[model samples]
Target chain A: MMRVEEKLFQNRYRVDGARAHIEIVDGDVCAVHCQDKPCTFCCPAGCYAMDNGGRVTVITDGCLECGTCRVICGEHRNVRWEYPRGGYGILFKFG
Target chain B: MSEHFDAIVVGAGPAGNSAAYTLAKAGLKVLQIERGEYSGSKNVQGAILYSDALEKIMPDFRDDAPLERHVVEQRMWILDDESYIGGTYRSANFSKPPYNRYTIIRSQFDRWFSKKVRDAGALVVCETTVLDLHMDGRRVVGVRTDRDNGSVYADVVILADGVNSLLARKAGFHGELKPKDVALAVKEIHFLPEQTIEERFSVKGTEGVVIEMAGRITQGMVGTGFLYTNKESVTIGIGCLLSDFKKSGIAPYALLEQMKAHPAIRPLLDGGEMKEYTAHLIPEGGYNAIPAIYGDGWLMVGDAGMFVNAVHREGSNLAMTTGRIAAETIIDLKARGKPMTARHLAAYRKALDGTFVMKDMKKYRDVPAVMDKNRQFFTDYPHLVSQAARTILTVDGVDKKTKERAIRKEFARTRSTLGLFADAFKLWRAFE
Candidate 1:
């Protein structure tokens, strides 16, 4: 099985290096509120992860723009999700 | 001062393009806005183009469309852990000209569609995000874009925005989408040589095959998987309900990995190199979960209205049909000098109800709920059915009747007789 990063490598993206389209409103919400960090698992791109320091971080570069992370995080409602700026983020080669 | 148009169509996917094309061809001033770099840059689907729908919109589309392959065969599979029981339908009639359906890559197909929209005289703009709806009190009048001084008024605003339309929710048009209402799907397109594709799929020049699968692959989730063949590539993917993924704690990508590893599936993609992987949400809420489709100056088409018939795995057709009908409704209303008000726009819903869009949705309205409650259908049934197949087919010393009785006993033991009967009734009612 290919790693998610390896899988995403085949796709194209014009990254908005400075601006993150998806934001974790509260970094500690996952540690304090969530029993199971669903976003880390449910995100198709595997964009969100809780590191060894007990902090949840989101990388927007590989984001599929699917909006799954926000919906599945109903418990904390901490994902401030939005589409990237026009012409940025994912560009499907053979969508 | 912002310019006012006859109609503002949002999103450049199938639905939006359909509306903009129809209105433009009717000589109405139309502005079609898309957030992508190009028409299909942000869209993805299993993407089987039902010619009937597009034919109604543009009768001669086949002459110049960016089609991949025409479908001549369809396979429906019920997969177990290692084996699958399925049926195939291949028809020579489907091989004839004016093909019933064709496989398409959404990005290229959408570019072609937007070209048609522009050629029809609709003003198609890309790389511009529609931030919100411009409303007078509760009635939508136009759209607010991300651009400076981007407020543009239109007599009718068609929301062909895709499933994750924040505009629909922010404008108080619909409530937040429930987890069960949407399925999160991940698909990868594998590139193979044209000859290799044709040889593997047992098809020749421009012919394609589509395999829709169910049972076990979704890991007991109320979802399905699919594999579609293109001219030189094959697209394979799996999807489950958002709620199911949350509960099962299954990683979305991991599910696809398991599906790709299936014995019945893996061999076909033996040497193909994957070129693109994508993930998107599908509106699977069916008829009952559909929001207020038409109100005041706005109409919601495509997945925005939850128009997908998940039972048949058909969405683009519904999107195209709803879009065309909505545009037609607006054109008719304008011809009669009727205002695009809530009362007048009810015709759009009426038009849809009279078409297969609403009728098919209504017929399978109970499907989502049935699949939601019946976890056994995705789990136990596959094992039971496969076990029965293995038992009845193997040349054992046992007699045929004895094997049949053993199969029945196994079913009764796995799911009590009463439970089995109730399950059958539920399935019947859901499909009925």
Candidate 2:
């Protein structure tokens, strides 16, 4: 009877740096001034944030590794992606 | 003789863990292999774990599982640009002990389940990818890994390696998933003070709310959006059929952005700090999309076999349930001294059919197609509904009868009488 909503908050995996690996390459942040900063709006985790100057910065650590940015970047080629090394990334408690 | 196990289960998510744990508990020598550093490391979900499924495997899960908040309420919204019409269902029974569903972060949950698998006496090796199935003509006997001397034999191989299970495809068990049968989803977790989350969501300790959305959120694309309240963060996401993305030419992120900026949605996350963003594909092929699930020496479970109930946003439970059933079937077969063969393994399908997994999926089998063919439901209906609601709810001097007439006219303007009747009938039939 465990419903779908209750499991959203359980952080079952702690990012032990040894297993979870993420690297942000240079020029990966989308620089496009498209009417809507899609990444800024679309990322569920809000990993991509737009500053007052309209530049987008990403803090990779908090990433759940859902792969949205890669697809949404839309051939922008601003993001280089790979799985977090071995054991580090968003671990699901119930998923 | 060789480094042989009773079973080798690949991937350590719900399905893998369930299979591994069940087998190990039954005193089978099991080896669960994971490519990620740990279980759940490579997983993501707006995850709501079904207790009925897990309780069948681990009855005491509630006592020690890393559970987030027990959801006491659910909201389904049909959204337009700035308005949504939806109903909220909240029940105090959900807050009671032996709570039904809880929100979970995939990374943490999988690790916890993996620990249980190990505790149940399985040998779990992480950070290793299973490169190929060691096949003897038509039968799989073992797996070869990337590391040296990494080949291991087993009596049965369980493919729980997730959505894009390359091993299954390589073994020619299934082909590449079709675009229409899959959905690409993106989600983010925003960190907020626990107190703030509690206050904003109008909940006490460890209580949560989940909102599932449709309509303009997907911009005529066949997709949905979701927001779930956690203990200290909110998980929000949007997903659509891959075919929708290809045809619409609008990025998934754009849909997500619009969903987040929704006036009804924005207030909930006003001051929260954004945390993580990620995306993954979900297998939504339903009953028709399931591939060959078993062979002479192997069986498939979880996303590998595409056991996702997209209508209910129920994938992990299906994964776990299917995994458990697969394990149970193997146990029963072993007890009967039957060899693992496709014919014998079809029992797994029979079990699934008797359960909600297949039943519910079959119930909604035509929904995805119906929605896809009817783009007006996503585009025009929400706007019309919202405008009608606005007109009705407005406190202007219009008479009640006039307001009702205006609402009727609004519906007619967007959808002719026949169109409205057809939509209603289609909806009724689709659910029926």
Q: Which candidate has the highest TM-score of all? A: 1
The RMSD of every model to the true structure, in order and in angstroms, is: 1.2, 6.8
lDDT of each: 0.92, 0.79
- How do all models score by TM-score? 0.98, 0.84
DockQ of each: 0.85, 0.18
Docking class of 2: incorrect
Candidate 1 residue-wise lDDT, B1-432, digit = tens: 288899999999899999999999999999999989999999999989999999999999988999999999999999999999989999999999989999999999999999999999998888888889999998899998877788899998999989988888889888888889999999999999999998899999999999999998998898999999998899999999999999999988899999999999999898999999999999998999999999989999998899899999899999999999999999999999999999999999988999999999999999999999989999999889998999999997999999999999999999999999999999999998
Best by DockQ: 1
Alpha-carbon runs more than 4 Å astray in model 2: A1-95
Question: For model 1 chain B, where is the 10-residue window of minimal lDDT?
Answer: B144-153
Best by lDDT: 1
- Could you give candidate 2's per-residue lDDT for residues B1-432 as a string of tens digits? 259887999988899999999999998899998877667767778878778889999999977788889999999999988889999999999989888888877778788899999999999999787878999889899998866788999889999988877788778887666667778887768788999988888899989899999888888888889999877889898898776776676655556666778899989877876655556888887877888888888999998888888878898888888899999989889889998878888898888789988898889888878887998988888888888898889999989899999889888877889999999999999889
* Candidate 1, lDDT over the whole model: 0.92
